[model samples]
Target chain A: MKKPEPVGAVKHRRDTVLSAIVSQIPYIRFLGVSFDRHGDELTATMAYHPDLIGNPMLPALHGGATASFLEITAIVGLTWASLWEDMEAGNIDVGTVQQGALLLPKTIDFTVDYLRAGLPRDAYARAVLNRSGRRYASVHVEGWQDNRQRLFAQATGHFLMPPRDAKH
Target chain B: MEDLADGMAVISMPYDEALIGDPVTKVIHGGAVSALMDTAGGAAVMAHPRAGVGTATLDLRIDYMRSATPGQRITATATCYHVTRSVAFVRATACDEDGDLPVATATGAFTVIPGKSKT
Candidate 1:
């Protein structure tokens, strides 16, 4: 357990850990969320599918899907911050594992405004960090289809961060 | 009937059996209405062929004007009004088949992502 081998020493560790965790999340995988880093922003995109349809008469996108997208974005934002901070502290190895634990303990207090009706077409969402602290973070996420805005969801979530076990 | 329009969609269902509460005999599930609003708004955004891959709803707020009737056909329409670099804003309304008055209204924000397929 040599102090988890310093963060810098595990440059690709965050990605590996995230990939593994994301792979096991069926709903997320089904949503086809792909992650990319742009400076401080982390973006997630998913294609529209029939499975996410809410109303058969209208064949529109489901609000649950929209909420799910927002939730995932919030999780990613928190994880991103955790990983970034760990890397800065040269303690990256614990970031992912710690993130997984925190994610399980996190709760969402989301507020959404249904501005417009979404089509049966594809859609995507992006989460932006509004603020972040030691135990909590707030994010403003938006979802779109074609080039228009379909849903706006935001939340401030609190995550319990505990130190990794001695095994790490 | 006017073509579904760019950001418009219709929903007609039995309110009696579909709803959950007794106080409101013809109670439309809030979730169901929200879903309809999302679809309409999403479609409005995707109306343009050149639009990006797809969009996802970030948040939605709905205000119920009045409860709908049981076994009645309801229509919902959503339109995307503004779109910034990464954010899209939309507004919507739901009503019965006659289109006389709105049963509910909603507003939402959506984020557009590049390289994704439209739903």
Candidate 2:
């Protein structure tokens, strides 16, 4: 009978997968973005940096930074969602993907709603997958600081899904 | 903002690895392009001939047409198409080395500073 994989190996694989996913996205690293994962769900964080400011007169975070943060959240969140089922079935093994990095969805359109001025502070966001099909997907991301209920900005993005048959 | 005139503005960002979205393709992220377009739109609104003071983005929609070439600076131009008592509308586009082909196009609404003159 085949034996179950040990817990340590499973944890190592998970860590490797996560690192490979993030490190491969240079923009996310450049923006100092990080993620906290719970199963298939992800919450992204961007710590405030001086370079993040666009209008220093108002001392507000650059709208672009906020927008980028939200979009990356959605993309990475979707990537995780795609991987969850395989991981659950014990099919996710690190160093197997010939694609080198996690396959990032291509953005077709993104609409951002700037609700409030982004203050100079750490920001948090979460992405909700509105719908995903074989060739198209939509995601909504909301960003906030200090309070989760009061969002500083939100975005709805539609993406073109990569071919599923393309080996992972 | 490199240049600003009546109802128009232009901005550009040089290519940097830090802004790259696709590690494999080395293409800049749509977010970076979004930020550029938003800033350009706001600049256009603030520079409008309608006695603008300050402005805030209410909503901005961007449609990406193609991936930007790696290591090419991106430039965006925005035109304030219309204005009202409390809002301004802007249309903008971004492009890279292939200046004729736009990387993305955007339309946005921005809040206009209150108190307009009768003239």
Candidate 3:
């Protein structure tokens, strides 16, 4: 009988998947944002900086920062889901994937609801995928801080999937 | 932001490598454009003749009409189209060098600050 892959190997592959995809995007890094992976899902985190404050009186985070975070979380979630399939089927070379082979999904449209001012503090967001079809995908993302149940902002996003064969 | 008059505002962002979304094409990320529009929308609402003390985004919807031309500055223009007792409605568009063709368009509703006015 053939033995299954070792846990360490699986962990290494998981790490590779995230690093390869996340490292290539400069905006994510420029915003000081990061993702924590759980299985195939990703939760994005952005640290608070005085530079992010928009309203001096309320000291709230800029709406642009909130929008970027939500949209980025949705894109990363959609991209990772697509690649996980290839990785599982053993169709992807980890080395090739790391060589800037990943393509960021295009935003077709996005809607954001600002429930409350984003307090000047660290924030967290999770993308709940609605659909991940080959041609298009949609995601609903929620952002919160301190209390997960209390969302400061939420968004619904639609994305155009990248062509797999690079012919498009 | 500038030209905040008659319930309208304009804001612009120059091309920045850090704002690029697609590493291959070098197109700026749509999120950056969204932010520009959002700020412009807020400025428009505050500049409205019936303006308020402060405004916050209630909801915003954005459509990406096309990819922004890389290495070009993008400008957003917002107009506060309507205002109610508690809400202000705004529409905004972002364009690069190609002014005729918009890179994105947005419509949003913002809270109408009570007891505030431009006059």
Candidate 4:
């Protein structure tokens, strides 16, 4: 029997880059962000606990949680995309690269549209790469809670490429 | 009715491991700082002479300086900058036992729900 073909190499590289990024954000480690990749997109899920509650009467998931969730997703998505770019360019120093070099494109503006209220339960977010270019990248992220959609936050992030003479 | 001259009300809570972002490292989460800011902002509005007015956060921006350690008592002080016919602007900061450096700084905008008296 022929050996099964190896899974897509890009995905394997993406996961490695993502795990590195998550490890840097200690808060994310506490929040328990789990990452899963699908083709070019990535999804992250975080479980909410009682300590994150802002309003006891309403039991609303604090907006800060929502903000952190969005920020993490953006960072992860950009890191994943940069990994692919580095691979295509035959650069192996991606691990030591700074965020500015990896995000080559800058996010000029973004918005988050809260669709529904979140409960003290698990929250999910998915980041989709809308466009990736040399100077900028756009990503759309949506968050869900208790199986209901809660937020739609997008980032138009810019990443600065390495300066000429810098070894990559 | 609580007097307006009392200045913005202050509330503080002891930091705990749960507030720490890393269970093992004991670094407080930035979100926790933001939450404390939000709570302080709301309490400042509620402490105003006007009671029964609901306040919802419109926008909040926080600048993080350093992370708080677990088991440190965090004191939050909120000051109401202005209260218009419908909007209230507030600023707050969080400090630990040392009180020399701020862990986080935040500013927020709140809108008073309809049919509520300022007093």
Best by lDDT: 3
lDDT of 2 by residue, B1-119 (tens): 67999889999999999898987789999999999998998888878878456778889999999999999999999998989888898999999989988999999998887875333
Q: Which parts of model 1 are misplaced by more than 4 Å?
A: A1-14, A24-26, A94-105, A148-168, B1-119
- Clashing pairs for predicted structure model 3, backbone only: none
Which residues of candidate 4, in runs, are more than 4 Å off? A1-5, A87-90, A93-116, A126-168, B1-32, B51-54, B63-76, B84-86, B94-104, B114-119
Q: How accurate is candidate 4 locally (lDDT)?
A: 0.61
Can you write out model 4's per-residue Cα lDDT over A1-168, one digit (the tens) per residue? 966546776555556666655665566765667777666667788777786665676777666566567656765666566666565454755466433233222223333343444577777787667766554566667787655443533223233322334423
RMSD of 2: 2.5
**Sliding window of 10 residues with minimal summed lDDT for model 4 chain B:** B1-10
Q: Per-residue lDDT for A8-116 in model 1, tens only?
A: 5454665665554454344456455666655556667766678877556666657656655665666666656656655546565655454443332133244565456
- Docking class of predicted structure 1: incorrect
Q: Which ten contiguous residues of candidate 1 chain A have the minimum total lDDT?
A: A159-168
lDDT of 3 by residue, B22-106 (tens): 7778888888898999999999988887878788889999999999998999999999999987899999999999999999999
Q: How close to the true structure is residue A141 of candidate 2, measured as C-alpha lDDT?
A: 96
Residue-by-residue lDDT tens digits, candidate 3, A1-168: 978988888878978878888887878887788999877778899999887777888989888889988998888888888888778666778887788867778999999999999998899999988988878898999999989999999999899988878711
- Residue A131's lDDT within candidate 3 is 88
DockQ of each: 0.09, 0.82, 0.82, 0.16
lDDT of 3: 0.87
* Candidate 2 lDDT, A54-118, residue by residue in tens: 77778888878898999999888877777767866777666754346456789999999999999
Give the higher-TM-score candidate: 2 or 4.
2
lDDT of model 2 at position A92: 68
Across all candidates, the chain A TM-score values are 0.69, 0.89, 0.94, 0.69
